[model samples]
Target: MTEQDPQIVYVVDDDAAMRDSIAELVDSVGMRAETYPSAQAFLDVCKPRHPCCLVLDVRMPGMSGLTLLERLQTQGAPIPVILLTSHGDVPMAVDSMKGGAFDFVQKPYREQALLDCIQAALSLDRDRQNQRETGHRLDQCVSTLTSRERDVFDQMLAGSTSKEIARALDISPRTAEVHRRNVLRKFKVHSTKALIALFAPAPAATQRAS
Candidate 1:
């Protein structure tokens, strides 16, 4: 198995002791962590990166954790965030979940439970990173297709047979078959089903007019 980069866990809280304790707990589990005294502090230093998640205190002196979460969402940043809350803050934390927080841990939390939440957040980040890389690769593959091949691929995806594709593109049926084979080869998919699975989001309008 390839070794993954260490997961970075950001701890943003107003209480210095809470930050220290959370950072220590995270470090004990072999993950990297950084402590921020306030949400603004986290925002000032946060350069978004993959395989990372945030542990944010719900109540902070400046820019509450929930506000920070809202900012992150507005910016379209993909980092997973786990909220930390006191007993009285459970209602707010529940609202944060509805707003896209991965999970929340109540204060006086079980160390094991927090660690499990961190692991889950890290897994989400990894899965998202993998999906982005796959999409980039697929885009590169599509870029390699010739115009005629793209036409054939799109027509095939739109449920057109080889003969229909030929009629649509004003090409011979054999030529349409050749283009179809090239499309499959370029995409590294053996069948139309596999091709569609990979590129289903591609627009149907890409098919040539008959």
Candidate 2:
């Protein structure tokens, strides 16, 4: 995939030697790693259009690690972060986790431990990407349905029969079937069973429940 594609690892740390060493390690493991000297430099240069994990230092000059994490939250960036800190900075590391950091490590940690954590973070980012893709595609399919088709969809998929849907919409059973077919086509479902199965999850129910 291209560099901007959503699967590369992005490293951000203010220490030049540390960044270079980590980048070398990443390269040795056959993964691409681009390092930045500071959080602002990373922000300025990174488009971050991918499944990425930030290897960040907990202490920095301007916008420290926690501050950067908060900024990322405000921007809705889904990039997973693995915070690195001094040995005595355990509290800061714990606070980072409370704030949704992917993982944290005390400085002078084992190389294998850091590498393993990066692998885990990358896996999670991939799952997030898939979830985003599925949700977006589902939304596009829903957009193809008209108002009445949507009503038929919501009611029928909620376990209402054709006659019940007709009564609810003040229409005949045959008219309800027409709307139901349109809804099925919009959702690309082969049958009513499949249509109902789409909204089987609890969150889906909460969003469009009867």
**Candidate maximizing lDDT:** 1
lDDT of each residue in 46-85, candidate 2, tens digit only: 8875567888888899988888888887899978888888
lDDT string for model 1 (1-210, tens) is 124677899999888998899999999989999888998988887786668899998887779899999999998887788888888988888777878788889888799989988888887777777767889998898899998888998897887888999999999999999999999999888987888888665332111111
For residue 146, model 1's alpha carbon misses the true position, in angstroms, by 1.9
Model 1, runs deviating above 4 Å: 1-3, 200-210
Total clashing residue pairs per candidate?
A: 0, 2
Clashing pairs in 1: none
Lowest-lDDT window of 10 residues in candidate 2? 201-210
Model 2 off-target regions past 4 Å?
Answer: 1-6, 196-210
